[model samples]
Target chain A: MSELTDFLNSSGLANLDWRAAVMVAVGLLFIFLAISRDMEPYELLPIGLGVIIANLPLTGMTIFSDNLSGHQESGIFGIVFHYGLSFWNLLPPIIFLGIGAMTDFSPVIANPRTLLLGGAAQLGIFVAFWGALATGLFDIEEAATIGIIGGADGPTTIFLSARLAPEMLGITAVIAYSYMASVAFIQPPLMKLLTTENERRIVMTPPREVSRLEKLLLPPMAMILIILVVPRSAPLISMLMIGNLFRESGVVPRLANAASNELVNIATIFLMITVGTQLSADRVFDTDTIVILGLGLVAFACGTVGGLVLAKLMNLVLKEKMNPLIGSAGVSAVPMAARISHHVGQQANPRTFLLGHAMGPNVAGVIGSAVVAGVFISLLPGG
Target chain B: MTFDQDLVNQGLTLTAIGIGTAFGILIVMMLLIQLMGWLVRIPARRAARARMAADAAAAESRDKALAAVAAVSALMKSAGPLESDAAVPAKAGTRKGAEG
Candidate 1:
């Protein structure tokens, strides 16, 4: 009876805390959303698995430290989290490379005006920054880290959080990715609220055919110009352009294929799992995390509003009309935000095809967010 | 820095700077893209002209080849029966000579 009691005490069920159980439930919910709703399966599924594994009472699947000897040891997930996310800062840039390889720049090249919309969308980051500062819940650095969640870019959010406020990395990354996945639900209502029905129905001319030479010139030119202007943005922008160059050069199909498919897949797994391990109950259940979540949503909404307002402002001076709906895609959630724009436009008018137009701002939003991150890093007090 | 003071001072300043820099950088990017487009078009135009010339030359050579093949066929057709008739008579004469 004594041996049995000891065994029971050592069991996971005996040691499981309420917080850990709550986190497990949250993880299961994420898994359900990934499998059933088919929303961001690659991100959420691994995160869910990581959460469950990390929370299991005595499994030692994450970080373990000995306080007396001042010795530290990390499990596999913790090592991945440290190397890929915290220490080496490798995963985000690699993810950017994959994004660049997968992207089609023609849509952006077709209409350069949409780049302004992307710039406008970054207004949310500042709004959130100020908002977070006002709350007194976060310091300036933490506020900056949280504000990037408005950019709707998981990698940029992670990069900024890891740099400016490593303490908030887990919640910020999770919130950024969650919002990205929920773009389908979040963006449409905001887009509709912001734009008039007439603006939504407005159709612009089809984009002209971009020359192959133009495509070939774009990546390198962009790389040189951006890196020259904002030196801090070099790592992310440079990797992105390199991947895009491989795709456009037409000389290296194998490399392009590997970057887009295999490399991205491997990186995503490591990134998502590592992110999940960071969501230990002690970190995630804090009042500040809740505030950050609320602030992130507000920031996302502000970005959408900013883009729409800018588009409308642009239309005031322009002869050719623009559909303001595509402006909502100016958040850097990639094709998801663009697709929402397309879907919303189609509802307004079945004939409207806003995908190509939205893609211009969508891709530009990636650049815009990276620029914002650079600005935060360069301008912050301690930075 | 304290929250209220920082929000009022540095926050506002950062806002202005951030927005200004973003718009400025993006505008510059837009101009650079335009410049690149214009620069690339010069070479593209030249390449286009060169391609057109090469295509015309190729067509001309192809037409010449076709014409030459037609002329050869015509010559072959016109000369074929006479050559065969001459050969037939020479063969008959040789056979008669051999018999005698």
Candidate 2:
């Protein structure tokens, strides 16, 4: 009878706390959203599973060490969090490399003017940084981490949050990704509200056909220029450009394929899951989290507005007028943000093809945000 | 104060620096792209010029060969008509002799 009672008490059911119950429900919501809605399924599914595993009471799976009691066990997720994120910060660079290998720089090269629009889009990062600081709930370091969510690039948000505020890494990264997915919904209203019917109807001329030699030279040139300016950004940008070089060289399909496919897949799985496991109930259920969410949205909206404003401004001076809708793609949600620009553009002018035009700023946004992130790293004392 | 004046000041400063640096680098990258375009054009332009020269040389030889063939055909055409005329006269002379 005593043995049976002991076994019942020792089970996960009896040991579960109210906070753990709440976190599990949160995890289930993410899982449900992923499976049914098909929203970032690859990222959310693993993260949701990790969240459930971490929150469960009396599980040694996520515990690393308790100095007070001298308890030590390296869980699989814990080890990944320590080595992959905390110590070395290797995951984001690998993801960047994969992004580089798969990316096409022709649109960007054909229209270097779009690079400024990409730079303009990063205004939201500082906007949110200001907002976070104004709230006084977070210091500059934490505020900077929150500010980066405005960039809308998952790997960059993850990299910055992991570097500066390891504690906020989980929630900040999740928020950044969620907002990136929601950009399709969030950007259209802003794009329409900001632009007139005439502006939306603007059709851009097709970009020039780029040469093979030009494509091959871009990676190394960009790598040198960017890294020379911001050495702290070397790891991310170098990997990104090298991956691009492999693709353009026409001599290394196998390397490019592995970087874009196998290497990236493994890193994303480990990185996303590790980030999810760090989000405890204590971290999730807070006034600050609510505030951060509001700031993140503001940041994204401001970023879209910033890009639109620049594009509109550019049209005033330039002879070959640009479609203002393409400016919103500078937020760097990859093709999704660019697609939003194209979609909104079609609503106004059915014949106008904006996807190629929008992609110029879209890829530029990736480099723009990384450069800003490096600035943040250089100026601030990280947590 | 609801907000820290010092933190806000720092934020303002950082915001300026961040925006300035990002734009500066992008502009530099833009100029670099233009410079690379010019540099990349040099080799391509040179190759195009070299190809044009080689084509001119080939065309020169082909035109000379065509002229030689035309001259040869013209000479053969002129000689054949004169020879046929003389042979016809000789045949007439033989006919007269036979008749006599």
Candidate 3:
């Protein structure tokens, strides 16, 4: 019994930090947000649980090796951190692949102008870039990576952050995905603030039905454009388009099903654990992290407004009226942003149908945000 | 610091800044492409609408032509030199009956 007590005393539990305790509370909050608020429950729940478990005070489980001189080589969580999460930055790309497989490009094909709103919405990316640089919160690469959180694209943010600012990858990704999940709540108020009721209620004529040929052509054309314009975005964009191509090719039913299902699940598990490991108490609860979260919210708000206002301007110049509410769909939160636009539009006009049209900007937002990330990464001095 | 250390530090800083500028340019280009996409669609949408209207008109014309052809066939049948069965087949039928 005395020998066992001595062994326990020699362990690192005596050095357990207070930050670990606080992180547990934060992790629980994420769980509440996921379960109670239904905010990205699929991702946030697992990530939240992983964070809580990873941050627990030393239980000798995290320690991997011990020396006669009392030196330890690794912790249980450390093993998960190094091998499971750090090396496998594969989640973002796979998630994007799933998104691509699920997306229908028909609306964008019908009204290509929505692509412009998608691009314009990325204004926040640059805005946040300057914001990060001017504030001196982080260096150029890290700042650019963090600023991509404004694009509301988790995969792009993760890809860029992993490449440019690997250390900041964890928080940046979390902030990006969290804001995207909650963007529904954040965007509606901003949309209401910018446009009048008339603009919101304006019912535009329905877009023409898109053809199968156009549907097949769109993802490839979009991929080609990305390859020519910004090679850096090709990884995420190409994979996305390929996933979509698999779905549209009609001959590859098995590949499409796999890309959208098992492949996504496997990638997500790795990604969530890796991301959760980054929330190591010491790193995430710091002053810089706090600033990153606040700035992320600002960037998201700006992107939302930028897209809507540009759309409203287009409405002014064009003969056919475009509903300004569709602009809020520019944040690239996918079905969520489109759904919010539809809901808000319906509130203004009972008969207004904006779901299909809103989808154009919604999908555009994804591509636009990625392009934005690429530009910022390319232009920044250290990036 | 040593020369090597100084070089490493400078390289790291430059890499960070390079990433930022690259990302900035990417976003700007996207905006430009978006603008061009919007402008290009105006003419295309108008042309598509025009084409649709023309197709509808063509479909209506084809229906009228088919109707005229059907009417002509019906009139020709009714206005034939031997319009009724009685006119052409009655003599044949009477001869057969007498023979039997």
Instruction: Give the best candidate by DockQ.
Output: 2
Give the 10-residue window scoring lowest on summed lDDT in candidate 3 chain A. Answer: A58-67
What are the runs in model 1 whose C-alpha is more than 4 Å off? A64-72, B1-7, B43-100
The lDDT, on a scale of 0 to 1, for candidate 3 is 0.75
lDDT of 2 by residue, A1-383 (tens): 99999999999999898988998988888889889988788778888887898888777776665356665666888778877887788999999999999999999888888998999999889889988988878999899999999998888888888899988989998898888878988999999999999999998898878888889999999999889998878878999999999999989999999999999999989998888898788888899999999999999999999999999999999999999999999999998999999999999999889999899889988998998888888888772
Please give the TM-score for the first chain of candidate 1: 0.96
Query: lDDT per residue, candidate 2, B26-54, as tens digits?
Result: 99988888787778789889999999999
Model 1 C-alpha lDDT versus the unseen true structure? 0.86
What is candidate 3's fraction of native contacts? 0.02
Strongest candidate by lDDT = 2
Q: Which stretches of candidate 2 lie over 4 Å from their true place?
A: A66-72, B43-100
Give the residue spans of candidate 3 off by over 4 A.
A1-4, A7-16, A59-88, A380-383, B1-100
Residues A1-383, candidate 1, lDDT per residue (tens digit)? 99999999999999999999999998899899899998888889988877787777887767734346644555777777677777777899999999889988898787888999999999889888988988888888898898999989998998888788876887898898898899888888888888889889998788878888888888888888778877878778898999999999989999999999999999999888888877888898789988999999989999999998999999999999889988888988988999899899999998899999999999989999998887877788744
Which window of ten consecutive residues has the lowest lDDT sum in model 2 chain B? B78-87
lDDT of 3 by residue, A103-134 (tens): 88877767767876776677677567666765
Candidate models: Cα lDDT each: 0.86, 0.89, 0.75
> In terms of docking quality, how is candidate 2 classified?
acceptable
